[model samples]
Target: MKSTIAFLLTLTATLLSHLPTPSDAFVYPKTPISNTVWKPEQDVTISWHDDKHAPLLSSSPIFDIFLMTGADDKQKKLATIASNVDGGTTTSVKYHVPHVSPPGQIYFLMFQTKDGSGMAWATRFTITDSEGNPGTLRPVIPEGGTINPGGIGAIISSSAKHRKSSAAAAKPAAAFADRTATAAGAHAPVKAANAPAASVGGGNTQEENVVVGGASSHKESSALKASAGGLMAVAAVVVISGLQFLGF
Candidate 1:
């Protein structure tokens, strides 16, 4: 019985350790808006959060930010700006709109992250002249006439190059959903439920690290509960075995 108890305790510990750990990575927090009338020759700020102790970005991997006009993947490139900005996604990049930029209803933003992950992101907003006049009139601008027609769309990160999003007002895509679309897309961000155990990799993986923060708090709780249940079961079995040994 003592040996069995010892083994069970070890097993519980092992199972607990197998829980998911999120890997170190970067994420976009405040990407450029998809449908706002930005001013020409204005500064647009894009920011992100960096969890991994990644050093400040430097040279080597090139970061590209460009503007496109039109909706969806059919956007036409209006300008391409190549840079080597050295801050991780945590740092905000203030892109200067060209004074000669033409006003349009579809102003799409496509920028590749500087991090080696090669995470590409696309966002959209309306383009208006410096006086806040949209080149093309949208049916409905937000209450103050600045937020553009649609709400923000969903957030997107891809490995593909030249990925772009709809420049149309946010009204159509998520229009039927009642709630306005947000950055990236019209749908809500995906939450991990019933996630599988993470693979072992020197104890450093996104699944493993997620326990420490972010949307995976529930996962951590479930893992702890499972480990507790396993311990309880082991205890029950050990008690029953001891009773049998004593002829109870």
Candidate 2:
């Protein structure tokens, strides 16, 4: 009788295992298959499938959707596509894809219940601009490099160094120009000093007046010497005439 009771309990447990459960509400994403390409600002319908055993509507009524990137382990949330969605009645949600910075090929969607009970992750896909081109990824700095906040460290450093070098090169040129100007100023006074002076009166300077005075003095001395020599000759002639008159 105990064996028969044990067999009956085992049969009941097996039957319960095959029954449907609420935990299988959303098990797989269906619309955004692998390698699907999407464009920014475009309307995208994200859909999912539930297990056959799942109920028509999930127990959780509200849901949230996110645009995610990167690997599963290091997934980065890009944006919130929808919030407070009615997940109980529908298996799909419509979202307008926003413009993502550094757009790449590794993008996916994540759907979760409001209470964080259920979740569904879609396959990885590509997000391109309206021109159908996936944007380039931002550059990554290598090891042991200087880092600047809110910017690319290596690029910023290189640009800063270039500006510094340009400034350094300009300093010597400016200094040389200043020195040239100073030397020119120093020589200006000398040039002014050597310039010919303006005549005071009658177009003759003080030097010309000195030369005229010297010529006048030399002429007066010569005239006086000639007058004395003539007087001496006349006196000699008078002396000779008196001696003849005496007839000695």
Candidate 3:
């Protein structure tokens, strides 16, 4: 009886060890294949498969999806595709791609459980512009570092150029105003000086006329005095001749 009981217990232990556990659960991405290509502002579908042992509705009912780039060691998260998704009922989700800067071919999708228990990554894919041209990814710039002149950098450069052109156009107008103000200031003094000079010239002319008039009056008075003296002498001579004839 004891040996049979020990044998039954050993059989039960062996069966229980082979059963699936929470650690054995896994999610597999399916939609983003190697040849898949997406465009900005396009609505795309992403799908995945979960193992039977996965806690789809129990421990992890919600999932999160993300767009990723680079290798596993240096992977970078580009954007969040979906969040709080029901993993038990649906295996696919739709996402609208935004206008991402620096479009490239080194993109992939990652599906993760809400509890961070299990995750899966899709194959590499491509993202192109409206013209179907493959673009380079923007390089990761460190803090306080300069960005390369492309993608977002190109947009910033264009904006800076526009501001510079506006400032350049304003410079000529400012300089012209300054020159006008200076010309006005210089001419104002000249006008004031000319007015005073004209008044002084008129005063000097009046003084000169007064001096000439006084000299002419003095000469006329002297000539009149000499004429009167001559008249008196002629009258005295005529009287003396009359007296000698009458002998009075």
Candidate 4:
């Protein structure tokens, strides 16, 4: 009984030890995306080549290819490009990765041989640009936000001045009504008419300047986000190859 058990144990260990190692000479093209902005209409291809000198994976030599895509926060396997290959000299596989959102990575896999081997290689490519869509829109800043205090004050003063100037430029009848309304709002004893008019004029000038300042902030923020996303996509491609040899 002891001898029989030892023989079985040796057989199991031999089978485990013969597991295939991912060879280093395998090569795949840098996967290409139809667009980088990642809209629903884009298509991408992921392809790879095997070294001719590498060991034939099995008696029949076959591969099963799979594609998985990442979008909107998660990775899901895409169904349209999954298949098994059995023939000679199959150095490449093509996968069409799907995109439905703004950010995504397309990953490709080839399981070596037809016996359901655990060994496989995978690489991720990124989709960029929306199809014919101009791209991410520039956002507008809300008025009266706290970006610039002095500039904000200047804008408010400028708007007030414009309103007063328009009233002054009008005929005397409109001017008197405007001054009368200002006087009625002043709870304290009314100041000199000229002094009150100057103060009201300055306020209108300030408000106009504030509106212009709001526009600049949005352009700056969106640019920063797009630039960062591009860098991350590049890094993913470079790092993913290292993991490919690990068979994960």
Best lDDT among the predictions, by candidate number: 3
Which has the better TM-score: candidate 2, or candidate 4?
2
- lDDT by residue (tens digit), candidate 4, 60-94: 34444433332111223233243345425444444
What lDDT is obtained when candidate 2 is compared to the true structure? 0.40
Per-residue lDDT of candidate 2, residues 1-248 (tens digit): 45654554455443343222235235466778655777755777777666443332455345555665432222344556666656455677676665443344455665555554455566556665444565432222124422100110010122233232222222221122211111111111011222232211110111100000000111122332343344345445554554455552
Using lDDT, rank the candidates from best to worst: 3, 2, 1, 4
Task: Kindly report which residue pairs in candidate 3 clash with one another.
Answer: none
Tens digits of per-residue lDDT, candidate 1, 123-171, equal 4456554445554433233343222222222212222112332233233
The superposed Cα distance between candidate 1 and the true structure at residue 106, in angstroms, equals 0.8
Worst 10 residues of 1 by lDDT: 203-212
Per-candidate TM-score against the hidden true structure = 0.36, 0.42, 0.43, 0.31
Q: How much does each candidate deviate from the true structure in C-alpha RMSD?
A: 16.7, 55.7, 55.3, 31.0
Worst 10 residues of 2 by lDDT: 207-216
TM-score, cand. 2:
0.42
Which prediction has the highest TM-score against the true structure? 3
The TM-score obtained by model 4 is 0.31
| Model 4: CA > 4 A from native | 1-46, 52-60, 69-76, 87-89, 93-97, 106-112, 128-248
Please report how far candidate 3 places residue 33 from its true position, in Å.
1.0
